[model samples]
Target: MNKKYQVFISSTYDDLKEEREQVIKAVLEMGHIPVGMEMFSAGDEEQWKLIARQIEQTDYYVIIVGHRYGSETEDGISYTEKEYDYASSLGVPTLGFVISDDASWPSSRIDKSDKKLKKLEAFKSKVKSKLVHFWESKDDLHGKVSISLMKTMNLNPRIGWVRATDAPTTEATQELVRLSAENSTLRKKIEGFKTIEQPDEEKRLVHILDDNTRKFKVRRKSDKGRWDDAEKVRNTLLEIFLMIAPTLVNESSSKTIAKEIAFEHVGNNWFRTWPIGDNKIKGMIADLVALDLVQPSKKKHSVNDKEEYWSLTKLGNSILKRARRIQLEEGIDTLEDKSEEDF
Candidate 1:
């Protein structure tokens, strides 16, 4: 059975009611179930428990950090912070959208309860990587928010945007049929170019043979041993790299491509992971090189010879096109299948 992607939105209700509604609408438009606190009354303890359950079930947790997010009530807990804490405890992949200076930053600085402001500040620091900030009146709110959500959900941005007018009409049915036939012909020609298995004696180049071998194998299991949610995120990153491979010509450096991907997907946390801390990202790049999706450039250098630049190969471009098609067909289902079992 197909799984629906669930998203939990955490925000201060007083500050972002309108914006939150817009966000909820966008999420529904994108075909994901949006869970927000507005669905329940504040006085119901049972409702809060249900909200926590929803957070646990969510694939992505989106926290909207406004100026008054941490402001406390008589009970000594800010509702926004409480939701964030609960989501973090469940090890959910979370993203934060902070209201920028353009949005009214709270001025009163009132702490109705003890040290609530300080607590909020500390919590913000802890989850800073997931945080994305934007001006209130940005012309492209949908684009910006959608891009950020795609990154957090590990989706390919190219496939995220869908046009209502892209569907074929009765007048264009013949054209569509003709194009489909042409596409099938091209696919056959492409398949013909695939390398066939070579004889053992012909594959004797030691370094080349070793390089072609798989370093690790990931397998799917029916019950146990499913890939974790983090792996799903890694796969999304791989898909994005494949999608952008074609446009990045031989002149484009690895740094340039990485920056573009970061800009398109990274959102407000762009500078947080500078220099690449994770081995997974590095491994993905190595895989790209091995698959000839990208090739090293002799002219470009990453500060020195120790670091090399890479550009996409022809085969890489084909893989990217295929990846986009897969994304369109499956949407976020591919990621959900990989992460659901782990959760």
Candidate 2:
């Protein structure tokens, strides 16, 4: 797995204890690490430092945004919000899971203080692209969250859930695939027709295409703003892998070692990418390999021989440690400022 797709889970303790646990379990089951306050010891500065470090090392920030975000904290800065701010500053991709009132809060009246509400509102506005809403009992939330995460990470969630029993079989899967291909073809034609009759709709489509194209190019360019930001995070994770290499290598394979580092700092999954150009992805891999931070693994014959595997090298480990340090420093700085403001 590449070191760039770590995920950090953030949430207020008051609202999402059991639910958080369940979410963490889901992440682990998906083969990613779950980083939360629970990963650290209680009331220990070292623990706080560790949490901050993990946050820095993470690739994706998963924040569980609930109603009572800041109410429980003496400083009035929800830990979740702090995490989000820190991740944002570091240019990490963030995802917010908003708990549905029907599931987490029985009423429309939120338990947050007025000041906290305003702060949360501002944060929400800032992170609109990375936010998603989920209800407790809604099975659809799983698919929605999965799809959103996959989109953010530039991955395809076509593998289906690990425990999914109702997975489409060979014939059904082929039929669905065929239908989807047909639908896409028809949609493209319809869109083309609409472009002629509806200038406004055509303009919207053009805008969307332009924006997505720009984003895609940004991801490819080494000096592009977003690409640079991602590079910073990638370097950080490489440093972390170095610090833990000795300990991890003794007990695990390179794949497991990379996975463990990703789980501890990012989320469970290590290899995730957005649905972008094949050439761009190949280029990104080449750059990482050239830097000596990542390497392609030996081919393994299994259910799928076409799938290529990659892992971190000793040099990559050093990079991850540096990245984790930066993340921790930024998180602590944000938390301190928020704490001072509360007083």
Candidate 3:
């Protein structure tokens, strides 16, 4: 899923303006939203409330520590420190960047007040308590920010925003909830019964896939070095579905599905191999949808990407589990015989 995360940037406004710009640029380049105190007037109770709310909504918190301690709140806490503390309290994933001790800096940007300098040192110490990067230059900071955020995001994913158009509709949401409840009931019932009769829906779907007349066509390189139609192959829908079902456990693009299908069905031993043609792939996907075996993925992706993403429906997963799970019986031959009879 291509999710756009919101990053809340915290730092002193004036001294680290250039650094802040770099961080914002990095965030934007990574296709995420960047928010900071630059948007609002500071040092007021109302403004702090608004800042707190914004921090709460943000997915990640990034703090840039420099020479200055920044202006303080009424409680003697610097605004930057307050933002960091609030974000930490809420358990937001934080990325801290502290200026290296050896960094060359102008005397004008350094903290002039003794009290503020002491607070600044304490704040830096607190920031260093966690995993952080030391940077001496804006460019250095930008690179580190991008790399760190990527790693953090991968290690710990967050619920991010999606376009309104891509979000599931009200009716779809309601249907999902209904189906979830039905699935739960069915599972409970299955647990209570040793051998439950197959539902008519499942039987019908299985029949559609099991039909021997259904065939998939492919093209292969000819002896003349041109593409030509290969002999039509007959693979039961159940077989094809089973081959590609695991990849669909997560939302996967059509390209990923094609690769999975090709790798499994089309042998690599062939001089040149091609995945199932797009049209045939689409037809197969549509068949699964008709059987309620798969559905369109609602996860967001980049706007530039045009590939269709798919995920297994509840029924699809249930069917897959039943088909692939090993039997409890210790008699392997007996279990194999029973499986063949059931199929």
Candidate 4:
């Protein structure tokens, strides 16, 4: 919808009449309403109140300066400056323009009194130091006002006046507020759902590897014993799993542990002494996770952290009761309880 603003013009009336006229024309061309001291009763007893009321009703304020400082209010500041100050205090969006210092003005348009000249210079300094345009003529000011007002309106729009019938109903506004609150609540609830302890494929893995190298390898019973003592190492590997299953219960963590296993040097042993490298370790943990004997811990683990930890699942715990005793009879023990001294 097209919105029209009411612009309150503030400047010395007699001196910058042509400048003010140009501004008013520009404002009118843009379909905005213009009101100024020229349209009001100048010397009325309640002039300040009237100006305050005008500023209250205005959607914007435009202050321009020339050579002269016009009539002053009881506070000794010019009424034009007073209007600008009042509009500013009320938080009205303001556009200011001033005559360039190099521009020549007729003596009739300037204040000859020393005090008034000082005030005029101070006022011009105040206005020109901020969001102000310096214009040499009415034509320059007209173009400046047109561009400034249009840009200002687009950037800092205000809550403008509307017809009584055009305003939103009280119930409709209340409904809008309620819906806004509900939208916020629903967003928070969705965030909570995302954080719940449920598996998410899209979520990043804690130990993500760019190189998909499958280093860990597990021994299989079905494999033929092509190498020396292959059968013995395979059985020992099973005992190793049963021994470490209680501590390294998660695949990601257990895959990283370097176990020091002590195995009896049996007859015709051709294999290297116990403990394996990366791929063999990972394969062992992978089989455990697949068998539901080991579970990935819910505790947050970082690859940089020493993440060699896990827990036995319910089935693993049940199997452990008997597996521990059987593994002891078969001469298997965790490195945590045994060292080179135990051998």
Q: Which lDDT tens digits does candidate 3 get at residues 1-343?
A: 3689999999999999999999999999889999998888876668978898999999999999999999887889999999999999999999999997778999999999899889999999999888777788998798678767865775577998998888889998999999999999999987888576656665456556656234655444333222354445655677678766766765566665655555444432122333456777887888889889999997788899788999899999876665533222222222235347867
| lDDT-superior candidate, 1 or 4 | 4
Across residues 145-173, which tens digit of lDDT does each residue of candidate 2 receive?
Answer: 44355445433222222333565679988
Q: Candidate 2 or 3, higher TM-score?
A: 3
Q: Please list the C-alpha lDDT of all candidates, in the order they appear.
A: 0.55, 0.51, 0.77, 0.65
RMSD of each: 13.6, 23.4, 15.6, 30.6
For model 3, give the RMSD to the true fold.
Answer: 15.6
Off by over 4 Å in 2: 1-5, 41-47, 71-75, 101-104, 107-112, 129-131, 134-140, 155-343
Residue pairs in clash, model 4: 215-279, 216-279, 216-280, 217-279, 217-280
| CA lDDT for candidate 3 | 0.77
TM-score of 1: 0.47
Can you tell me which runs of candidate 1 are displaced by over 4 Å? 70-75, 102-119, 129-135, 138-141, 155-343
Worst 10 residues of 2 by lDDT: 212-221
Q: lDDT, candidate 3, residue 124? A: 95
lDDT of 1 at 69: 44
TM-score of each: 0.47, 0.40, 0.53, 0.49
lDDT of 4 by residue, 263-288 (tens): 22221121222234445666756766
Q: What is the overall TM-score of model 3 with all chains considered together?
A: 0.53
The CA lDDT at 21 in model 2 is 68
